[model samples]
Target: MSDDRFEVVIVGAGPAGAAAALALAREGVEVLVLERGDFPGAKNLFGGILYTSVVNELIPEFWENAPIERHIVNRRWLTLDEDTQIGLDLKSAKFDVPPFNNTFTALRSKWDRWFAEQAEEAGAMVICETNVEELIVEGGTVKGVRTGRDDGDVEADVVILAEGANAMLAERAGFRPQMGPRNRVNAVKEVIALPPEIIEDRFHLEGRQGMALEYFGGAVKGTVGSGFIYTNHDSLSVGVGCLIEEYLRLNMAPYDMLDEFKAHPMIAPLLRGGETVEYATKMIPEDSYDSLSDLYEDGLLLIGDCAGLVNPSIHHEGTNLAMASGVAAAEAVLSARKSNDFSKARLAEYRERLEDSWVMKDLKRYRDTVHFLLENREMVNEYPDLAIRLIRRYFTLDDTPKDDVIKELWKTIRSEVNFLKAARQMWRARKTML
Candidate 1:
């Protein structure tokens, strides 16, 4: 209730932090969100599309007010070679219409600012341009946060860490391990401006409907990473990302890989003459289930990417998990407040809540996926070329027998990768991903 104290303090104003601030403030809890950026979203970026169900639970029909570009109606998965690509494009009319769909493309800088405003409207005090220097702890319990400004020690009954993927303050407070030591993927994205009509025509869309495309194989220059392209209202988000180890091994810059991806035969045509207006680089935590940081301690909790809550499955769903964990953290904080107990044992309920929510369940289900896929990098590099070769042969309309073509395709696949190794990897994928 005072300038120097609040019932709950959240660091970082990304999705998770904002979600927590909104939920707590709506319930009349004194919550303070500290954002290091000049504004809430000045430093935030995402591939594109926000899974809005969790957020909608907080703000019903949020799309009507949020700065959304388009609602996704099509999903494309492409396997590419140097000069060729094979893809599956799925589109549905069901996604074009109230409750249109759960996903929408948004510019984070715009979306996050609006989201923080929502929190502010609900009575949360959000202070931007303030970097938390350290957590004030007493007797191993978090008491408040220390910032750079004079007399900047602000007190709080509980501190929630939603400070994005880098989690510097959490690491400094010894709440989690250094993010640099964990498995991280470096990604770079650029927003290319295009005409709205051109975007709709090129992607086969109509009236605010959008498409999301993901690329494998040559996208990462055959490294253990992937690339993505998403259609905004009048722009395209194109980026490439790879594991830190792969980046070092390949000696490739994330932006350089993105440039190469943009120029690919199958990709270049899509962005023929678009002008790029925005660029961002981010670090995604690929070690979701295995290397999750400590989630809670006395009077403190961690949520979102700070806790390594990313789902490293094929979907790469991070924002949904972030919002879900934020809600769970807020609920736990409310419970602790009701009991007037902010000890470690009381805060442990946050983990229990996540375990019961889809955030932990989904992460647990695909826990082995990242490791499995990383170990099988050949699937990203060799198999796409093999697939292209087989597809080319299959539809060549030659005078050869269909059975003979099948035999040749099988032979070609075996020659590129050891049959046993491929089979083993396939089996592991089935066991882990399917």
Candidate 2:
């Protein structure tokens, strides 16, 4: 064996890659993690919401020393209709207790680097600023990767691809195909600085406590997109994500939609007097299980955004899936190393593990759901409008028969959205979600 080569080589030192590297290193395996950015997460962005379960699996009680913005205590989901908002609120005083199992806001630029350091400390060698160009192949059996340097053809028994959204290497190797318009979304985000006290007052929270507000409807220029505003210690992460198909049809720059969302009457006040500190944009794969491409080959495993693992239907839960897949890949590699077998048949265990776990099971459950929602265009536009109109009518003070109110509701719903269509959507949602 060459002195420089290792048993496993992981590309992209973000959550999945770092998690995989750390886990493999902890198991006493030789792992190498490579990052293209100047550092592990210099090119990464943050919505700042991270689940503790994912991190705790690798580093139990991670918040003990990690740079966490705040342990979240409040959550609000909002549907906006012009100037009005319909809200669902959930808050628990118990969340402030130990183990804080939910989540906290974070900056990836700092967190990813820290995670990479953890991997390094666990005995994985992480080299930064080295971009892997393509996978080195031999007679259709996966072997290793070729980077962009003179001695760049680094060989390994196994290669784990955790490259974020582009996944160019994965597409090139035919492990997965390129995403269609429906499978992709363009997300634009900004980190704006505000006083910590102002953030507390505007979001109606006590000292040092943070709140998350997700906005729909009025912010997207009536498009099939939503706005998100999540609080940090003294900064707010605000952004919008729209399907690539919708973005092209509207011929609008993402930044324009970002501006519209900020200027929204409901949003503008919270953001008032705040200064935009940084801006970033990235592609997120939101096509659910139907978009599941190849996950395994002879000597390679794909994890994280490279495999298109974003569940936008929920809280954009890709990182957790990434970590889980990383763990599965590491386990498969460890088993194969034990048996000295790197055949495709042996590597199929990773896929089986994925299916048996929540990552693949939940994704496959919602595989057709994205298409279901996209097919029903009115749900994003007309349906929400109908709901707001019904609420407005119920509160109107004009003298009218009480039974007439029911008739008015029916008339409005039928005129704005066909009853048959609405009923079909409800049925489809129930089936698809289940």
Candidate 3:
């Protein structure tokens, strides 16, 4: 093997690439991880939760040393109306203890760096500021990567693409179809800083406990989008995201929606005296399992968002899926390497492993969720309004009688909601998610 050739080459140092590098390095494989940013996390703009199961397995008790912001012990799912909001708030003592299995909030800038460091510690070569221009294919078989450098054509026995939602390299290589606005979401986020005590008091948090608030309905100004606020140690990660097609169709400004959401009657006071510290934008592939591209060919494998591994379920799970795919890819490569085989047929094991893992199973389970939501935008736009109206009237003292209010509410629902549509959606949700 030449000096520049490696057993495996992983593009993008996000969770998937880093995880693969770590696992492969531990197996003493010659793996190289390339990042286009100045550092692993420098270009990442995620402001969401990370489920720790996959990562925790990679690094036991990772929370002890990781750059985690907060351990979420409280969850709030809100539906905002014009002047009112309704939602569920559940706090669990079960999630407050060690491991914090529920989830935790983190800034990708710091978290990704730490994760990549783990890979480096395990003997993986992670190079930053290296742009992998294209995959080096020879006679319809994947071989290596061509980077933007004088001596940049680095050969590898196998290449794992973890290039994220844009997946330009994968698209250019014909490994996957170009992602469309219909299946993508443009999210804008801001990290608003406040005193730790103030944040604690505001979000009803105690100690290192945190809250995650997810908003629907008017939060996106009646658009097919959603908003979120996750408590950090001393900052709040607040953002709104909507389908790219909806954004373009409505000529909606994501930042403008964020502003309106911040000014919400219930949300504004929580950030009354906070200062915005960081702002970022990211494109998330929300299309479920059906939209996933081809998983493997020749010596190439696609994992994470580049492979459409994001679960578009209400959970919005991406990180865990990414890590799982990474680990699975590493295992497949190790198995293939044992036989000194690097063929498309051999690499196909990666797909089988992913399907056998929760990554594909969970995604397949929620395959119809994004489609159902797109077909029924009213669930995010009008239904929340209807719900708030009904609940408000029911609680109002001006109600003449309880039974009368119930009858009136039923009449309002019958007039405004398409029962057939509602029934169909309910059935679809039951069949797909339940």
Off by over 4 Å in 2: 1-3, 396-407
Displacement of the residue 318 alpha carbon in candidate 2, Å: 1.1
Q: What TM-score fits each model?
A: 0.96, 0.95, 0.97
Q: Pick by lDDT: which candidate is best?
A: 3
Model 3, residue 304: distance off in Å is 1.1
Question: Which has the higher lDDT value, candidate number 2 or candidate number 3?
Answer: 3
Would you give me the overall lDDT of model 1?
0.87
| Clash tally, candidates in order | 0, 0, 0
TM-score result, candidate 2: 0.95
* Model 3, CA-based lDDT: 0.88
List per-prediction Cα lDDT, in the order shown: 0.87, 0.82, 0.88
lDDT of each residue in 360-389, candidate 3, tens digit only: 788888888777777877767777789899
Measure candidate 3: CA RMSD: 1.4
Model 2 lDDT per residue over 20-53, tens place: 8988999999998889999998998746687767
Clash-forming residue pairs, model 3? none
Residue-by-residue lDDT tens digits, candidate 1, 46-151 = 8986888898888889888899999999998888888878888889999887566888998999999999999999999999899988998999999989887788
Q: Report the lDDT of model 3 for residue 340.
A: 82
